[model samples]
Target: MDKKEILDTLKAAQVYLSRLKSLDNELESAVKQIINTFEETERNIHDTFSNLKVVLVNILNKRENFLLEQAKKAKTDGLAPLEECRNVISSKVVGTNKLITQGNSIINGSAKDGLAAFSKNASLLGSLPEVPELKEVPFISFHVDPTSDNEVKDILSQLGEVSRIAPIQITELCEKPGAILVEWHSVENDDRLTDIQEFRLQRAFGDVIKEKHLLVNFNDCYRGLDTQFLVKDLKVDQPYSFRVCCKFEGIQEWSPWSLPQVASTSLRPFSWKISDDFLLSNENKIAKPTVDSPKVLYSDGPQFCVGHSVEFTFLEIDSSNAMLGLIDQILPTSSSLTSTPGNSFLVDKSGKIFVDGIEKCTRLSEFSKGLKVCFTCDLVNDHKVRVNVDCNEKRVTYDWSIDPDYKMFFVSQFYSPNWKILVE
Candidate 1:
């Protein structure tokens, strides 16, 4: 063979050798996993059955004691009247016998006191001593259900089920400035049983996984069967471990949690980092108007980059103009948001949008209380950042001349007092 053919053959051999090595490693790992699973599953099963036994025993003992006490109570209650009647009859017998002895003594002896006693006793003998008549006595008895044993056995047979844990895995993890998006799926995707009821996602601060907080949906309940979820308001630039477990339709317990995956936010956790002449509280999440004049709010300065979004929720909006604006440079304390800086874009409650203080004809719905406004900066392989505004379910996109490398900050200003804005 030529040298080229020899080289090609060697390369083929090397490729096969690499594949063989990978397969061997996979086989070894699978064996180890199998061993661990076997031991762990066995131990879990043993503990489960042990607990079941204890519970069953306790139930049986409680029922047995209850029935025994019921029987004893029945016996005591039933014998009460019969015992009282017997005592009355015995008292009458004793009284009659004493009267008989007194009469016999009056007849057999010749004393005057005996005659007096006989006279007294004769009045008692005029009528026979009253004796209580015995009626039908109470019969106390307990009967067990004929089919109870068989019924208990049947119930025990159907009490609990043993099913293998579902293999749920986290498929994707995406990190944002203050959030992480997680997506997962079941490995055993059995289409025949579309009975997945819900899924639970838990997150811990570090890799130790000691304390975990269950993630809630926007409705503030545990997440349902959706495969993807975005956990927001997380601490930025902090490592968090997350795991997911699912509940099937008939399962009482959620399936075992998936192996934890760690993800950390970059840059900063988005919050209202600065405010314009307003009192900011709750880590700058809430802005309260301190002065009767117009107030402005600002997020972290120059840190808002591409692929990031800021949401503003109006908690209380008075009868005044609420403005949403963005600026690249730091605003001078002397400069007011109403002045509209030369390098800023704003959308006011009057439905007018402005670019660099120049009014644009784009009219959006007027802002109101309880209205959610989201501003997103997106640019894919482009120099200019595309700012998209979502308000009242209406979307308007604007391409700003600002370069993607040039970071900017979001601004919200209101004219009236008692205006509360929540920044996320």
Candidate 2:
């Protein structure tokens, strides 16, 4: 054959194959469409049959009711209303009664809600929460923490529908005028402050207040401070079971804390764990991060070029303990650094004495210094004496001439070390 004839034959074969592929795609699309239509038709048929079944059942029920009504009339009781005649036939005739029974059963079985939906004892299975009696109104008078209104609402809602819980009112017992005071009332139920812990409104140590001791003429063993007036938000006219004691003039002693006291009426709160790590932790920075913060440590301070981790020196507080903070190391004494020579007491220029190379404690003032820590001994001579230290590294700088000054008001003066001159 010629070259043109060979090329023409190849073109024909390629066109035939293209047409066959196109036909196959069309056939597949048509088959999928037919299948989808069939499924849709089947679903529609099922829905139509379900709806028809309901309609048929309603019609048959009406027919039965009407036929029974006619039969009731034939008995000649002469009921006037159609509904009344149906009810009579439904109750009286055996077959009609069966229909009536089944109809009632249908409603009972099909209907849902309230006591009707539940099996016998299902209502009993779930107990009605004990309704709290309002012996005392839900009062806002207590050591309230920083509680928001929304938090109070949440607590009240859980206890029961709060008929009424009043807002906070502040006042203080007369003696401690600066201290906080509040009062709240529950008009309807004892639901206020029931779950103070859950509401994030419980009090803590940092909350401070002044208290008054009022001894009323009323002699009650249960009440103390003669009257431990409300302080730190403690309630008044409220029975508190606490151990308390008091001391008077010459040789008086404090009383012991009394037993538990309860308000007139309160909900028995469910026991909860004492840990407040969740709510209070956010306010206090003590919630240490497991991962270091200020995330990107800067290169401003150069670390050692060779080591993988840094080695820092912390003052050794105990020979056994491995770790210490800067504050923990400073609080302890330098007792291990004291020195002593064999027992002759010598006095320093400041009228303090020295025995073995250490000092002897002669005066009350001298005892306040490190001289008391040294071994107790009498002066070697009938005379008082003095010694001096010129060494730069001694680190001993206490002067025994003046007493460590202090005030009676504070347990210890924070800024002065002299205040640490602990009483024996």
Q: Give all candidates' CA lDDT scores.
A: 0.74, 0.29
Stretches of candidate 2 exceeding 4 Å from the true structure: 1-6, 76-424
| Model 1, span 1-424: residue lDDT tens | 9999999999999999999999999999778767866797789878988999999899989989999998888888877776786787787678779778877776777444866666765675445434434455455667778699789889778855444544678888888667887888888756623788888877766653333342321123247878887788778677777788788788777776677678887756666765455777777777877677744567766657777777878888777767876887767755676685557778887778887787777777777878888888888456677888888888888887777777777887766667888877
Using alpha carbons, what is the TM-score of model 1?
Answer: 0.64
What C-alpha lDDT does candidate 2 achieve relative to the native structure? Answer: 0.29
Candidate 2, residues 274-380, lDDT tens digits: the string is 12221112112111112211111111122111101111111111112011000001112221111321222222223343433455444312222222221111122
The alpha-carbon deviation from the true structure for residue 421 of candidate 2, after best TM-score superposition, in angstroms, is 99
In model 2, state the lDDT of residue 334: 20
User: How many Å off is the CA of 69 in candidate 2?
Assistant: 2.6
Shift in Å, residue 31, candidate 1: 4.4
Best by lDDT: 1
